[model samples]
Target: MFFDGTLWRDDAMIREGLGQTTGARMGHMSMCGREGSIAAHQFVLGRKVYIHMNNTNPVLRGCMPDQVGAWVINRHYYQHSIPMTDAAYMSRVGDPALRRT
Candidate 1:
């Protein structure tokens, strides 16, 4: 597993308790669980795999030219879509009782 020791580096908790190695302390915890204690990385090692991804959108990390091209070709890759056709049909012919849906 990749141990990113710097993800929570210089965070508030580390500065407050651990004296601002950030989580740069000799023994710190994970950013989520223990609040940036470095020792947390110890458990992250070994056979287990840490995906090492953030909760944010991966696309924001800077997409490649080919990735953008493929996205243009296969628009469905982004499933976050609004069914305008269905909405229009409903607006014209749907029951008012079901409009609350």
Candidate 2:
């Protein structure tokens, strides 16, 4: 599993297996809308996912009508989709109403 320490690293694959350096904290997303975060998601490759997002993470807002939707619909690669409210995940995970027909 890759553990990227930078919030926006140029190339995460390079540091995928290397151990953390002396002082490295986890990455975080602080952009206002989802465009920037969504771009980062698309930049990565292979079985991607997100984690430890703040409640206000852009994914929560569903703001990037173009990019975020593209990721959810076409790419199927949720690179930065964590910190979701229980209801949001449940809605997608279990609720029939949330699924596409």
Candidate 3:
């Protein structure tokens, strides 16, 4: 589950009971942003994956080699796994009548 926006993040409330609940083994959080926009404070608990995105945030300019520890598979990389043909992509973007029967 992805929890976005600052208003929704309740660390204590989330960790208070949900962390130890039955079948809840581990929780990981990833702050997907440019660079400076995604602060260290956001990733306070659990395993945090910081995604320094250039298009998403302007902070990516400040993200140095040290700040970015490793290269992880992002959404775009995984998206390639799903086969997309002209038929599928065109149908979604074009008029409904243009879609092949």
The most accurate candidate by TM-score is 3
RMSD to the true structure for each prediction, in A, is 13.2, 14.5, 13.9
Write candidate 1's Cα lDDT for 1-101 as tens digits: 53432234435344445344544354433444454434456466465322222223233248778855654544453233447666777788657888657
lDDT of 1: 0.45
**Cα lDDT of model 3 by residue, 1-101, tens digit:** 22322212223224434443221122322243232224635556665444423232333445667544332244454346456665567757666676654
Positional deviation of residue 14's Cα in model 2 after best superposition, in angstroms: 34
lDDT of 2 by residue, 1-101 (tens): 23222233322323443435311133344232353354546666786555333222334355567755544553233343443554466666665765433
How many backbone clashes does every candidate have?
7, 0, 0
Worst 10 residues of 1 by lDDT: 51-60
Q: Is candidate 1 or candidate 2 better by TM-score?
A: 2
Clash tally for model 2? 0
Where is model 3 more than 4 Å wrong at Cα?
1-44, 51-56, 65-76, 82-101
Reference-based TM-score, model 2: 0.24
- Model 3 scores a TM of 0.26
lDDT of 2 at 31: 30
